[model samples]
Target: MSDHRSESSRPARVPEPADPPGTAGARTPEPVPAGVQMSKQSGTPGAAVPEPPKVPAYARQPHPRQPPSPWGPAGRQPSSDLMKIRPAAPGVIPAATLWSVLATALLGALLLGDGIGLNLFLVAVPAALAAYFAAQAAGRRLRPWTAVWAVGGLSLLAVPALRDAGWPVFLAVVSAVAVGSLALHGSRGWLGIFLGSLGLLTSVAGSLGWGAHGVRDRMADSRGRWGVAFRSTVAAVVLLIVFGALFASADAAFADVLGSLIPDVSLGEGPWRLFLGVIGLVGALAAAYTAAAPVRWDALTVPPGPARGRLEWALPLIVLNLLFAGFLAIQLTVLLGGYDKVMAETRLSYAQYAREGFWQLLWATVLTLLVIALALRWAPRGGARDRTLVRSVLGTLCLLTLVVVASALRRLDLYVDAYGLTRLRISVAAVELWLGVVLLLIMAAGVFGAKMLPRGVAVSAAVGVLAFGLASPDGLIAEQNVQRYRDDHSIDIQYLRGLSADAVPALDTLPEPLRSCALDEIQRTLRGSDAPWYATSWGEARARDILGDWDPGARVRNCQELGSGDQGNERGGDGTGGPGGDDSYDPYDPY
Candidate 1:
């Protein structure tokens, strides 16, 4: 009885609160099955302690100082975790393989394509491959329609007319953006497409981070194998260089043979070219990888505000409308008056009057477009009177802009007819045409609201430019100029002769005497026996097809014989020429 009393009386043991789940002193609760009985050794008889279910590391709270991860939410992984963990199935392409392929492509591009036209395709092929590799790395799945678009867009470069148009960079940029947007996001909404395309620039640093981590893991696993390979490769390269130099210096015949095999590598140019090639390759790879795996894009959002008050927009628009109305009246009066009378009143020549109005009117059209866009973005909600006034003002502005665009086009056409058609004049004419289309689009948007109008306009304009490039710029210019020459006999043969290989195919469509002269000049430029087979391009191939069995000696002799038979001082005293120029005077100086 006394022993029992002693056991009971010994100060009852008090349990400290068990440490909260993950503290250092916490005990892992033991698992208990249903109906299990606990002994006195347990916290309490007939009671079971159950283990807490494990939580994933990501789900668990991290250390307070640790920043959240750039890639995902867990945080910057510790060295241990980085080594043990695996990225998801997506975006896990083997880094080494991609790098090797890119390196090989860079080497191939450097070895091929001596001519500028061929070089464009060589550069483009690697660029496209890099983009595809990046898409794979980014975990983007290509859809069927997108794949077709990509194929068709790239194939344009292989077309003789399109490639020779000398707009490769322009076409490639637009097409690549279209393809990349399709891959990154299945939708082609303008905002998403543009944002995704822009995001490629920001992805470069992220790609480097991911790639560096992957390389580090690979290096750790096979350090010895890599070390042996690297050492052996370095030794072989060094030995070859030393022996080649020694043998060549010892014998002239050997040096000559070596020169034939390897070519004379300038100490300066060789390193410079190699350095530029490396820079271009790395930049391309970085861009491609970024496009494949884009991070967060800054979304397009409207400015936060209520529509602007009527006082802010109404007064200015009314004044502008009045001004535009007055300008239109004056233009109409000038049109009613004869060309000579208008020029006399303005105290300007026909050429000056035509040139001056086109630029000023074009500028006015651009400014008016900007004003209308701003009004749409910010003009306040109002009563019916206010709304009617706003719409009317906007509608009037659009109408006035159409008039301006038409007048500008007319002026430009007159200028071209007076000076002969040129690349610049033709480009300006195309712009004027696009602006007219945009004005019509703006008018429709005014009635229906402009939520997608800007994007639609951009897409249309880009497509229009691409269509023009594909149709062949040189061909268009030559056709127009040849027609003008037939009408007035005011042609600049020397300028036609000076055009790039792109113009060679087009010149074939000209009349006999002019055609022969143009072909001879172009043939002289392409004459080089050392051009590599890999440098063969669509443009050069087309030129060869048109020119036919060329003999350099015969072409030069024909040109000299033709030069002696010239009729007038059409090309100046010494047959050296351009618009109002001797051989030394540059026609492009006026522009």
Candidate 2:
């Protein structure tokens, strides 16, 4: 029993692996799966140990620690969640851009002194060309549609060169330029067009920094040449001052020659020219930058409003249609069969009858447009049934509103026939006509999908403006009034005097004193110091040619006497201080 215990107490021998011949001193470790503990066996000798399941190589690597955030705990955000803010990348400005900007500056100094005219067209041309070339140099693909907008913009810019109408033409030109710039890369929605146009101010502001950077880089690259040019300019200026004074002191004839050669710029004029030059430079830079990196306004997405139930959507529109239909029936009755009867009942004259409800009808037409726009926004978009309902109800309302537009126009026509065509009357008539066109476009849009409706409306307005400018509103007003004067042997000498130079041709056809009274203001304007060739407009040039030989001073003295004596005999006068009398009449009043 002691021998058995001794044998059991003896330590069991474990097997040892032999190393290779050259690596005998170092023992190789046996491959073990990660995360599996290697515990020594205590039982039978030479028994094989079971292996643990293998772990993936990726799982075997330790996790990397994150770096500390510089912004602190609260300010720290996940990398994926952070929005990146980047400055506009500097681009290589084309040589054409620099030269064009210089040209624009010089032209602005020369032409903008008088007023806007052909000068605007002349200055804008180079800027536009530079933008086109810069866009090409920047490797941007010009959209085909953008060419149309550019053409339209240039055409509108030419309006001041052709017509002498004041604020209306200016507004049209401004709208065209802003919208055309936005469309350079093709905007998607009305919001995109509006916001992108507004952002142009910011673009112009940024151009200063961008242009300065570009100039600095260019100067750095051509430092030697730039220094030479700077020194040469300074030397020339100094030489001219020193030598010019000596020559002027020596000879009075030379001084006269020098005086004629150099323009006499006033202190205020110098700053004005400098301001205009800065405007030109900044405008060209903005155009270049915009063309190079146009905002992707088309990428902006506006989700539609949530759809409503068919009944919920169609009910109000149906009621609106019914209301429009009722108004239409009444308009038809009053306008067609009951005109004389209604006039008799109201105890109103022709002009009074036409002017009474004209404004209310125009407002109704405008408000109807707003209603249609809102209805389209919230209209049901479920299926075929909903689309049909929208088409039917909205279509009827549009048709009825068009009739209302016609009625408004008819009333204005009658008013013009009774009183005469003033700018106010013709302008409102044009607006009513445009609104009628808009309604027709909307009706067409309902038939075809409304996806392009916004753009369509913009295009229509542009077309309308172009047509109005081309037709020459002031000229048309003059022609119509002249025709009325001839037909009735009566005219408003005062009203024609307020017209621009565009009316000169029409007014020149009037007899003697009337012609002189109408052309006096325009002749005085043209007789002033002649504008530079670039600043002169076609209308002003023509006016000068027409009034060159005729003197208005002698005839204008008779205008007051003639106007006062004939005031009561005006066509629409009732001789009781009525619509036609000078005291009661206001040619400028829109309503």
Candidate 3:
């Protein structure tokens, strides 16, 4: 009874109030930290608790900033609108571009009727000048290096005015002009140059659409006077045609005067001139568009390939270098010391020995260059040691390959001396020499750097080709054969006969029958109706002058006899008539 009375005396236990409306179950109970105790009202009674864990300073710091995503917010794909190609700003075509197009069309109409000669130079130079002015009018600053390519292209275009060989010079001129167009903007690296040249085709096609758009915009503008001018010009043309036809039909004198004043548009010549004019107009528009907004080829950078492991990269190159060194050592021994003894032991004549391996060496030199390029592309870029190894191995390989180039050239020289100079022989020798120059450039790049090597190589090739055209390859071939004939009376009359008018002066130095035989075809071509001044070349003019005072009738009989004797010898001389017993070989065959 006393215990019960004490319990009741303990402040009659007060009941807790209920939670307010809308408050019950609204909040989740807070999570207790590890080793932290909860109140008795929230947890089981009499539960044991421990100390809380320690927090590190780094964990308490704020998070660092993150890079923005390439996609839209929350990682969605980009919007389609962003990916679409925007149309060019609405504006009329520049007046300078229009003037340029008109000038180009006029030049084409006047000059293209004649064949390619001074016409090529006149057409090409004016077009280039027009493009420059158009670029300036478009407010674009010309690149400094543009002049180099322009000069190179213009100089090449002048080849037709000088040389008579048709195909090679034509190809060189086309390549130079294309590369020059690309340079009006700018490019970097080999890939940029290649793609930029290719892009010119697309630029030309796109210009049609671009010009159409510009015309539409011009027509839509109310303030433009072009529409009025167009209508008035059409009306004037229609009225003039009606009145002129009436007056021409009324009187014979008026008809003759009208016929003289207006050019007769023949079915053949009229369409060709129109087509040429259209081509010129299209080309001018393309040039102007490109100058206004060129593709940024230099901005397109290629990421480097994966870096290679040191051993994986170095071992193969080292082996290649050693192989080249071994081959070069043998070449040096044979070239410098025992050339005659080796030839005697091999039982081969000088020409046979020279011809047998010269091509192989040339191909090897070319392949070695490709290998060096690939090595540089995949080379390790980690440390100084890797750089050193690259320089030593590749540099040594280049040096050895250069010696191979020398050997190849020496062999070609020996072959030419034994036989005679042909277009094929001279062209290949020039290519091999240019390849040697490329190797020297590579070695210099190794010592310095490779940043400019690609452009340098391209520029050198252009210079080489230009020099080749200007040097007059066919002329040189004829001169060499003439000198050879003087040295030893061995002459290939048939080969000289096949050459163009550029060889006329050289062939004129020969005696009567030989000169008559060689100049027969060329003289016939020149003696035809003379071309206009715009269509004449220096070589053709010179040929006319040289043959002006000469007569072919006196030597015709001797030429026939000489030709019959050569045919007799070819058929009866042990069946091994031509040089090196290769009777089927054509001197003009590039291969």
- Name the better of 1 and 2 by TM-score: 2
Candidate 2 versus the native: TM-score? 0.78
Candidate 3's displacement at residue 583, Å, is 7.6
- Give the poorly placed runs of model 3, Cα more than 4 Å off: 1-91, 215-267, 336-339, 549-551, 554-591
TM values, all candidates:
0.63, 0.78, 0.74
Q: Please, what are the lDDT tens digits per residue for candidate 2 over residues 110-217?
A: 567767777788888888877787678877776766776788778888778887778556867776677668655466576666666654565676666766776787
RMSD of 2: 10.7
lDDT of 1 by residue, 266-373 (tens): 556666557656655554555565545443332343463467777777888888878888888787677547566666677765445566678788888888888887
- Best-first order by TM-score: 2, 3, 1
Backbone clashes under 3 angstroms, per model: 2, 0, 0
Query: Which candidate model has the greater TM-score, 1 or 3?
Result: 3
lDDT for 18 in candidate 1 is 56
Candidate 3: residue pairs that collide? none
